[model samples]
Each structure stands twice: as structure tokens, then as C-alpha cells.
Target: MTVKQLSSSGQFNILCMPEPEREIDGVYIGDLLSWVMGKAEADNVWITIMSNINVIAVASLSDVSCVLLAEDVTLESDVLNTAKEKGINILSTPLSAYEAALKVSGMI
Candidate 1:
């Protein structure tokens, strides 16, 4: 599924969608930035609770389809802006990372 389709499906709330047409091939759930960077596959939806600026860097490096900020985590204004400038698709959800991952898994 594409980021736009996923967001419009009402499974999660989209926060920043600079690349809504990005394709989602899989899902990755992680909190450690380094771990996620090393393990997350390209074109996967990354689910994490961390909403820092570093998340944008990791997402760009890993080339993930999008970042799902779980458990209602909110990003700082600068971080959100950076995500937009960097063309990162970020979605937010009240669900935990596990739940978000499960939903994404079912989707793709």
C-alpha cells in the first residue's frame, strides 16, 4: 500500500506527509535509533515512539516508506518541519508501536 492510501484508510492520523505516494512494502517496529537504522528495510513503514529530529535522519538514511509515531507521540515543530523539508512521510497514532505494526503488517 502507499502512504496516502494507508493514511486515508483511517487506520492512523497522518502528521507530516511529504511523500504520500511512497510505497509501503513492509513494517518495522523499533525505538532504538541505531538499531532501526541497521535493521529497517527500505520501503517499510517504521513504527516508533521516538519523535525526535534524529528520527527524520534515520528515516532518510533507511529510505523507509514512512514513519509511524505511535502512542500519540508528538514531534517538535522543528523536527516536523525538518521531516517536511526532507520529504519524510510521518503518521501518528494513539495505538502503541505493537498495534501500529500489526495494522501496517495487515495492510502490506
Candidate 2:
């Protein structure tokens, strides 16, 4: 399913907008920045508790579809702004990345 679709479906929340939906139909990876950049694939829905500018940087470098800042974490204003400019989609979620991962896994 597409990112928008997934969000509206109530299965997952869309933390970022204008994001590509790649891994939604497959799997989700909820690792930290370093591991995610090396191991996650493009179009994958990346869920992490981190809510910093670096997360956006990692998402951009890795070409991820979107990022879910889970566990009630939020990004800095500048980070969100930069991500928007970079065409990176980052979403904030009430649930932690671990929770989102589990829900996403069960759906796919």
C-alpha cells in the first residue's frame, strides 16, 4: 500500500508527507541511524525513536520513503524544515518505533 493509504487505513500512522511507499507492502526496519543506513532498503518505512536532524540526513542518504519518529519523539523545527526541502518525508507518532514495527509486520 502507498504511504497515504497506509496512514488512512489505521494500521499505521504517516509521520511524513510526500514520502514514497516502498517497504509498507513488505517489511519494516526499526533500527538506529547507523544500522539503518547500512541495512535498510529504499522505500522501506523506517521506524525509530530518534527525533533529530540526523534521522532526516540518514533517511535522505539511504533514500528511504518515509520516517516514523515514534515513542512520542519529535524533530526539531529546523530538521523538519530541512527534510521538507530535501523532499524527505518524516512523520511523528505517538507510539514507539517498536510498536509501529510490530503493527506494520502483522499487516504485511
Candidate 3:
């Protein structure tokens, strides 16, 4: 599933849609930035509760299709802007990280 389709399916709230058409090959759920950096595969949707600027960096470095912020986590203006500038798609959801991961798994 693409990021745009995922957002339109009513499962997630898109906070920053810089690359909505990006394809999601799989899902990776983790909060530890270092672990995610080493393990997250390209084209996978990374699901986490982290809403920091470093999330953008990790997503970029890991080459994930997008970043899904679980638990309704909100990003700061600067972080959001930087994500947009960097062409990183970010989706938010009220569900916990586990719930979001399950939903993404079903979609993919």
C-alpha cells in the first residue's frame, strides 16, 4: 500500500505528507532510534511514538517509505517543516504502536 492510500483508508492522520505516493513494502515498529537505524528496511513504514527531529534523520538514513507516529504524538513546527523540506512522509494515529503496526501489516 502507498502512504496516500493508507492515509485515505481512515486508519491514520497525515501530519506531513511530503511523499504520499511512496510505496510501503512492510512495517517496522520501534522506539529506539539506534536500533531502528540499523534494522529498518527500505520501503517499510516505520511506526514509532517518537516525534523528534531525529525521527526525520533516522527515516532518511534508513530509507523507510514513511514514518508513522503512534499514540497521537505531535511534532514541533521546526521538525514538521524539516520533514517537509526533506521529503519525508509522516502519518499520525491515535492508536498505540502495536495497534498501528497490526493495521499496517494487514494493509501491506
Question: Which digits, one per residue and each the tens of the lDDT, describe model 1 over residues 8-89?
Answer: 9797998889898999999999999999999999999999999888999999999999999999999999999999999999
TM-score of each: 0.97, 0.80, 0.97
RMSD in angstroms between candidate 3 and the native structure over all alpha carbons:
0.7
Please, what are the lDDT tens digits per residue for candidate 2 over residues 1-88?
Answer: 6666656656445545765554454445665678998888877778777777788789889877777767777677788788888878
Query: Candidate 1, which segments miss by more than 4 Å at Cα?
Result: none
Model 3 steric clash total:
0
Candidate 2 global lDDT: 0.70
Clash pairs of candidate 3? Answer: none
Counted clashes in each candidate structure: 0, 7, 0
The regions of model 3 sitting more than 4 angstroms off are: none
lDDT of 2 at 96: 62
Model 1 RMSD, rounded to 1 decimal: 0.7
